[model samples]
Target: MEHKIKNKVEEPFSFKKRLESFRYAFKGFVWLFRFEHNSRIHLFSLIAVTIAGFFFQISKEEWALLFIVCGFVFAAEAFNSSIEFLADEVSLEKRDKIGKSKDLAATGVLIAAFTALIIGLIIFVPKIISLLN
Candidate 1:
């Protein structure tokens, strides 16, 4: 005798399920902050920038740009981390395709970081020069 199995479809998320998902996301963020080295670095940089923004009395527009760039870099890094994690989990072995995907994600993060660095230099150089002058 042969047995047939039926496939069950998952229902859409309800409000409670959505809340639980948000809670899980928050927990993931906390876990990342606590354990991820790059996340720690980004957190430190974010704090430093916040302090500098306040201390330097950076203009509103400059502050906006600084925060935007900072957010972009950190978000890209987080995305890179997620991609690498998924790739590693999906393939325990060092597959070339997975490796390339991870590398591309890392490259994206690097590009964002480098762009942020340039923006920081542009924003801060004149302020530093003025201080010296």
Candidate 2:
């Protein structure tokens, strides 16, 4: 006996749906900035780095790397916050497993943040050296 699998047709794109998605995303960003202290810190750092980029006149390649790393850090923070929210809902009482999971999620964001910092230093250090010489 041969089994036939049915593929559901993808829904046609709608302008309303697209707008709704953007609205939801903006809401999420606002929520994170409001509630997540770390996210706010990252936002401040992002602004400072952007201003420095302009002052230094970073090259196209440098700008690309900066933007990519910033995006990764922001994404990492959002994922971490989501996991924390889920964990809090899952259990109010302290449990080792839940604590471990939350710690791991936080560590992921820390790693992304440090990676971005290192990349920023790499890109800008030589420029600093050139200025001092």
Best by lDDT: 2
Please report, in order, the local distance difference test score of every candidate based on alpha carbons. 0.82, 0.90
Off by over 4 Å in 1: 1-13
lDDT of 1 by residue, 77-129 (tens): 77887887789789889799998998899898888878888988898888889
| TM-score, cand. 2 | 0.86
> Each candidate's TM vs. the true structure?
0.82, 0.86
- The residue pairs in collision within model 2 are none
Per-residue CA lDDT of candidate 2, range 1-133, in tens? Answer: 1232222244676899889999999999998999999998999999999998998899999999999999999999999989988999999899999999999998999899998999999988888899889
Lowest summed lDDT window (length 10), candidate 2? 1-10
TM-score of 1: 0.82
lDDT of 2 at 91: 94
